[model samples]
Target: MAINFRKGIDSSLDGVTKLVFGAAWDRKAAKQSGFARKLALKSGGKINLGGGQKDIDLDLALILYRDGEPKRIVIGHNMDPVHGAAVHSGDNQTGEGDGDDETITLNLTSLPAWVTEWAVAVFAYKLGTNFDQAQNVSLNVYDASNQGSAVLLDELMPTLGAGATASIIASGKINRDATGNPIDGWTTTLVDKAGRLGSQGDDTAVLAFAKQNAGI
Candidate 1:
């Protein structure tokens, strides 16, 4: 599929069963002060915020909703499996590598029937970290079941710069039709909003965004 994401536009997930969602970035070298380092440590101590390079850490999560109400969040911080191992998160604290820094896998068939909508979100987790401090930041979706011939289903690349100060972003959403059949019931929409809803740190923002998006 020639997947192109436009804000607020939805793409079909016709025959896709399992998917891999990837978030990637490369950190830029920068000077960190003592206070900054302390702050980074205070916020979970997930990375070393030294003076050499600014540790740009990005997080990927899924906010699940049932009947337009936020129910659960599948996050990487604690590595908890949701919906009977239907969704799993791969957390990366450092943007040290080439490709995707963090990933989340979703098995649509394993999801519970109550799950009506799911929101895809990524955010800058480390203190003082923003999209501007990273290079080649992007979120990608791939057909995981098609291992040998995996196809790129969709992608969302956040623009980096001055306006990229937003710590969190609502990347996209996967909504299912309760009354329809499995394959034709699910639809994925690209939200691509950077902190436009809220940025209250530990996912309060993403939760609120999901609820609002669901009109609840």
Candidate 2:
């Protein structure tokens, strides 16, 4: 609906950071069960193992809902600046199960009731200089249901260099069927480049739905 930015007061990070563009939700909902579970399958299917030029990685998550049901979906992956490979870490599928637990958590009870659905995404960029690279990323949100898992913005692809930032934009409002299940009505786009990239260019398409709905 509306977006606003303010100075960050929390000590989480030094220097001024943007705050509360609107009603913000945690990375997760109940911490027990929610949209996090729906993303496990997708997460497992998108890991990239092939080696290539080093680049920044971007992680993303989306929250969508209808009639007070919250759903969470996550997009984690790496980008090779030189080789131009957009590798996706895949969907977390389910909440932290065993092994490498890489899911973001958030509290939802504190949010306003009108906030029916929300989404969060995290990025783990520039894992390491060589093998055994680690992804550094986190993003999540709260809502009523986790029905937005079917929609994917785009396939992860390489950008340009380490200096450039990987950006993704999703636009469109959540549409539901007679049963309130999430239907497709939005479009998503992913973009890579050098220097700070805004919601523009070929990348602008990534956020088509986000721009129309959440205005992210």
Candidate 3:
């Protein structure tokens, strides 16, 4: 869908912040940092998997906001995440068709008094085979505040073919939507490499919309 930001509210907040939370695939002795802990705590703690093919599952959460005010937003849980609004409890292994994902939202006008920044967390799990050495995963934030849904911030894609498990966290700004209208929010796009593992990879690209952007 196209988001036009020509009409709507824009954020006067400062520049965006990006944080990558995950262990390096080669860091075997690395310990869990505060980023990982925060995700676990925010997502009710612990990572759960379902039954299906053995594949790596990545858990992600994006916190949106304006001039420090938190905005209500959701991510893809199953296919669409934003529109699907799929909320499944517990994690699933085996890479089953069932989707085990999480969503996040902030009250744009009522952000936490102590929160000075926004955060995006992600967890990457290797199910059957490891990721391709030439492939990289990226997290994209779209300006869902308008009609065009433009991309506000995108993290540098990660290379997950190092033969290790890990997670990552990054921060971004809530820019105007695709049409240039500023609704004070944004969405997420999870990008994977070529193929996943066994099955032709499917190389799914999930797009999540911000609830506050629906009006635009």
Candidate 1 TM-score, true structure as reference: 0.72
Superior by TM-score: candidate 1 or candidate 2: 1
Please report the candidate that would top TM-score against the real structure: 1
| lDDT tens digits by residue: candidate 1, 1-216 | 444456565666666677777787777878788887988778877666666765666777777777677878787764554745445556777789777787777777777767766776666654566666777778778887666855677667765445353323333334446563343445676665554435535557657766665333
Worst 10 residues of 1 by lDDT: 163-172
For 1-216, candidate 2 gives per-residue lDDT tens digits of: 112111121111111111111111122222323344445445783543333333322334333333434332323432221121112234442233323233322223232233344433222222322111223221221121234432221222222245333322222133456654435422222222223333322223323333333332
- Mind sharing the TM-score for model 3? 0.32
lDDT of 1: 0.64
Ranking by lDDT: 1, 3, 2
Ranking by TM-score: 1, 3, 2
Off by over 4 Å in 2: 1-60, 63-122, 125-162, 172-215
Could you tell me every candidate's TM-score relative to the true structure? Answer: 0.72, 0.23, 0.32
Better of 2 and 3 by TM-score: 3
lDDT of 2: 0.28
Q: What does candidate 3's lDDT look like per residue over 1-216, in tens digits?
A: 332222133333322222222211221222456677677667786642332223344444443444444453223333232332212233332232321223233333343333233444343323443433212344433333334433443333543445532222333345554554554543322322222222222222111222122221
